[model samples]
Target chain A: MKNIVIIGGGTGGTVVANRLANRLYDQKDISITLFAPEKNHIYQPDLLFLSLDLSDPRRMFRDEQKLLNKKVNLIQQPVDAINVDNKFVISKGKKYAYDYLVIATGARLVPDLIPGLAGNNNHFYDYSSAMQLRDKLRGFKKGVIVTGVADVPYKCPPAPLEFTLLLDYKLRKYGLRSSVDLTYIYPINSIFTIQNVVPILQKEYDTRNIAYKTFFIVDHVDPEKHEVVAMDGETVKYDLLVLIPPHRGQQIISDAGIGDEGGWMSVDKYTLQEKNHEEIYGIGDATNLPVSKAGSVAHFQSGVIANNISNSVLGIDEKINYDGSTMCMTEIGYDKGLILLFDYSHPPYGLIPSRLNHLAKVFYLDYYFANMMYGLP
Target chain B: MSDEKVTKVIDARGSYCPGPLMKLIENVRLAKVGDVLDLLSSDSGTKKDAPNWIKKTGQELIGIYDEEGYTRIRIKKIK
Candidate 1:
């Protein structure tokens, strides 16, 4: 009867919670408790569409309670702290001790890190901020709409490109298409991190005639002035701004001396187990993997993490290895998209495309609704 | 709908997560509002990913069949 505590009920956390629940279903002694902050679970990937008004924004989320399995206990409370040394999770002024723990808090987007980001206008990076930007984009009719990355390792590297394309479609439909000067700003040398999809996206940009401002690292945003200042002293003004903020790990990880220089959880590439603590396992954006922080990577790592945790609990040797598999879909427009697949072990394994590959993304959506949203095993 | 559409076709035999779902999305786009898009994927993670995506997109999932080669799912797009 071992107690397994999983923290954060997002992509990685939810998969681990459900997988463990099924593995220990017949065992009355193995208790699985999941701690998360909100009752509503937003499919973070859909934010790209939501920001651009391409899809029904209401479809982005459902009550978290509706998503989890019946066998697992759900705690809707912000984790105040994690006493890793003591092997307990502290949340909402309460603490639960566990024989084993899984850290899946993912990454935190810090708008405050950039100057003038949170001014009276609008900005976004994470869930709450993206929602705010969604509202702001609704009434916006024209002017410079500048979308840029504040820092590196932000979740879903292809998201910025998706936003740009969708915004192009939005403006064109609104008749103010010619009025809105849309510019996609990024610090990276290219539009996408995955090299193979770069050509596809560049074609989309050219077809849409969207402006591109590369190598402009946003240093700060001035809300009252309606402008974003770059680190190089160049300023880009905007009527509405969609910015991907700087990302960092949870405070608990940094406080516990378990994070890298960028405040990301440091873990071994082959084994997701913490580099410092063998008992601690991490998945999703929390890990300092040099890959794009997307949902597919988390799903791929969850299997590896679950296998290792199960073996450790049963005192059996673990045989799984984390290969850092991630897949991304770049939405070219309303009716068209591109699929990019990569094995991080191979470092940007270019783009391999087939008609079958596109179906995989659509099939994943149905799979999540039936198995995850409905609380099915 | 004939034997071609009825017989199971696991197109995602060697594909990954969004790869399978992206195909379904395109197929559904090609389909009329009531037409069905059937997909087969090898990734077990689809157990959670596929359904959640349908719920978000408002697509109707007709059925899901689990077989030896892969998992099959049928979805119909609703306007």
Candidate 2:
């Protein structure tokens, strides 16, 4: 019997696990098991809505066991190490041997990386932080509200932009738009990493009078002074700060010597196979893919990984390749949003922000909760 | 369309996408057969989603009216 082990039960891992189980169901010799530490699977994209009071945080997650396929065995334990040479994973005190391993541990926000930024600042990267920011926003009156990203290569690149736009809309609705000073700071020169959507987003910011500062890399924060210091000697002060902290892959990947300095696993851009270890595959936020580390990217990568794994098992030389296709719905507030679709071959293109797209995002949330989580078509 | 009166009206004008669709599904389940339900939604997606859901569930879509800022969708509970 062949054992197929998957690590991380997030979007990428869950999809790959379910697809592999369904494809190899007839093959009684194959067994699939998934190791996930968390009991609840969070619909992360909805965190933006949760921050804006558009949705309840309680509705954003469901039990992970209920979402997994019945055919796949799930072990709720944190993986401590991966012995690639022995083809086994060490979780807690036990070890499970596998013929093939798929890593989808995804990324984690490292707020403490930036000194003094953890406690004083508000962030919406996690469920609790999003809830905290929601409460902070309600109590906020009139002052400078600075929303920015601390580093590049963060998950959901458009999230900070979405938050900024939503904040502007909420403040306007509260009749405090004029009293508040809103600013968006980006590490790069442009408002967005995707070139094509930069002008469109800039136009929206301009129309809304939302000030943006470019080329500001966050070095540290002075909580006592209510200021953020940049690496280039620039500083920005705020009464309330919303930050997207730097993100890195799970530490286990790095400890296993399979990840880079940033703890992200290095894999082939198209094939998603680990560079030094062909038997291992990486996808989603955990991999060092030159694409946005968003759920949409994870979902697309799962398709490629699943096909390639199946091909390998069947002794087929042909393999499916991922084109780095990624899409994100940027909520522009006032019940309106837009879609950004791009890939390796194509440049990012913006579909004008409208209420229709907002509805599309809402539809996606429902689909993700009902069908995608369960790995159903 | 004029002959059939709306028995229940779901004011989902300010609600977002699946919000309106979910509300429609919930209310439609409790609605009796031949009862007409009207959903007012500003979300452009519901214009298509509501009708698609109605057709998929074997319900009768009576009419869709284009209002000033929102769309009014009428459905008959056939199932």
Candidate 3:
């Protein structure tokens, strides 16, 4: 049997596993295995909503095993090393060899890299951290709530906006909208990554009266003094600080010599195949693609990668190639939502005011439950 | 899926993600247990999307048929 080992069970890994299973299942020639350190799969986009009690964290999270098919084997253990020289993946004190490897382990959130940010009070990435932020949000009523992106290319570019909007919603619900100050800090100069959605987001910030600090690259957090210090020596004091931390590829990917200067897997923009190793492919936020690191992009890339991987396995003609497809739903507080879509396709296809995106984002709940929760079963 | 109901259709073309499912869900809420909803979807993900959405909500998926440049989804609304 041709063994295919996939690292990481995030959005990219899950989609690739499912797509490969759809074709490789019932076949006698291939065996697919996915590895991750944890069984919990958090719908990251829902984390913003969770802060305001608009969404239940439990409903937005699930066991990774539930999202995967039975035909494939799942290993829930951290990888210690990947000896690319010998073509073996060493994890959990065991070694597994593979004919092909897919590195979908996505990016890592490095709050500690920001100095004093990953302390007891800091909750930036993952479910437990988000849950911590939710608790802090519930108890506190008056404070400067600042949630900002730690660095560039963080997952879901619109996340800071979503967090700001959710905070706006929560403040209003608690009747503290005017009392508690809210600010959105960003390293980027604009609100939206794509220039098209800037006006709409600007209007949202204006109407909600949320402050946007431009080009504020956070250097570190002095949690002891409740201060977020920027690289330019500007100090923003906050009683409640929710920050999106910097992200990097898994250590094993870097150790295996597969990453670029940014510590992310550098692959061909079109093929998603590693530049150094032809036998290795990447998907989701793991690859150094110039698109938003969102689930929609992973879903789109997984489809293209799966098709091409199958062709590579069978020695057939490789037809499908990823055009850097990416889309994300931005929740602008309350029940109002905005959709952002773009691809490598030159025509620039996406819709903003189209209610279709809102419906699409809401439908994801059903999509999650059906396609991910039950489809594999 | 009755031969008679196959003729009954809802023009859900140009609808995007969950729009077809939302409309079907709304129409399904008013439908009898055995009543069928023939949903049409143009969204790319609809091929696996509608059936998956129906399965999660515990609705019965009758069938998914391919039409000219679109898909006709037959779903039975179950409580």
Candidate 4:
């Protein structure tokens, strides 16, 4: 019998576990197990809407145990370390051997990397932070609100932009738009990495009268002075600062000596197989792929990894490649949204902002919640 | 579509995508058989999703009328 153990039961891991169970169910010699530390599976995208009082926070999370297939074993324990050479994982003082290993432990947000950034600024990435920001916004009357990204490769690339747009709408609704000064500071030269969407976003920024600073790499924050210092010796002062901090991979990957300098697993861009280890594979934000670290990208990677793992077990030479296709449905506020689709070989094709796309984004969350309760799609 | 009187009218014009659909589904659950329900939604996804849901649940769809900025979806509870 062969044992397939997957770590991290987030979007990628959950989808991979379910799909693998469907493909290998009839085979008596294979067993599947998923290790996740959290009991609740969060629909992260809705956090943006939740902060803006547009969505219900209660609907954004569900019991993680209900999301997996009945055949898959679930061990809810934090991983202590992974012994790759020994082909085993140690969690909570117990070691489990695996014939095959799949790593889906997504990125970790490191706020402390930037000095004085954490506990001094507001961010709405996670559930608690979103709730905190909601309260802060409710009490906010008028001030200079600055939103910035400290580093790149953050999850949900369009999230910071969405927050700014939604904040603009919220402030206008509160009749404080004129009193507040809103600015977006991006590490890159453009508001978006995709060149095609720059003009469209820039036009919107101009129309909304929202100030934007490009090439502003945040080096540190001075809470007393209410300023953020850039690496190039530039500084921006603010009354309220919202920051997306630098992200890194799980510490266990580095502890196992299987990750790169940034602690992200090194995998083939097309095959998604670990570069040095054939028995291991990776998907989602945990891998050092040149793709946006978003849930949609992880969902797409789940398909490729599931197919490749199935072929490996069946002893078939056939392999399916992932084209690095990713799409982001961005909420541009005022009940409208836009879509940007791209792949490794092609540039992003931007769609005009419409109310339909906004509906689609909302529908996606509803479908995701329903699917999680019912099992595999 | 105007000849038949609507038993209930759901004013979900300003609500987001799944919000309108969820309201329609909730109201449908509380409605009796042959009860006609009207939903006004500005979200474009509900224009298609509501009809699809009605067909899936073995209900009757009267018609969808285009309004100024929103769509009016009419359905009957047959199941």
- Angstrom error of the Cα, residue A268, model 3: value is 0.9
TM-score of chain B of each: 0.79, 0.95, 0.80, 0.95
Clashing pairs in 2: none
Point out where model 2 deviates above 4 Å: A373-377, B1-79
Q: In candidate 1, what are the lDDT values of residues A224-343, reduced to their tens digit?
A: 788788655778878777777777778888777787545677787778888877778888888765556887788888778777777777678756988867778766655566676667
- On residues A60-152, what C-alpha lDDT tens digit does candidate 2 reach at each position? 788888887787899988789999989999988798999889999999888887898888888888888889999988888889999988765
Score candidate 4 by lDDT. Answer: 0.82
Interface RMSD of each: 15.1, 21.4, 18.7, 21.5
CAPRI-style docking class of model 4 based on DockQ: incorrect
Looking at candidate 2 chain B, the ten consecutive residues that score lowest on lDDT are B14-23
Please give the lDDT score at residue B11 for candidate 3.
48
Docking class of 1: incorrect
Query: What is the Cα-based lDDT of residue A167 in candidate 4?
Result: 90
**Which numbered prediction scores highest in lDDT against the true structure?**
2
Question: Looking at model 2 chain A, which ten-residue stretch has the lowest summed lDDT?
Answer: A368-377
Q: Alpha-carbon error at B36 in model 2, in Å?
A: 72
lDDT of 4 at A47: 89
- Model 4 ranges off by over 4 Å: A371-377, B1-79
lDDT of 1 at A314: 69
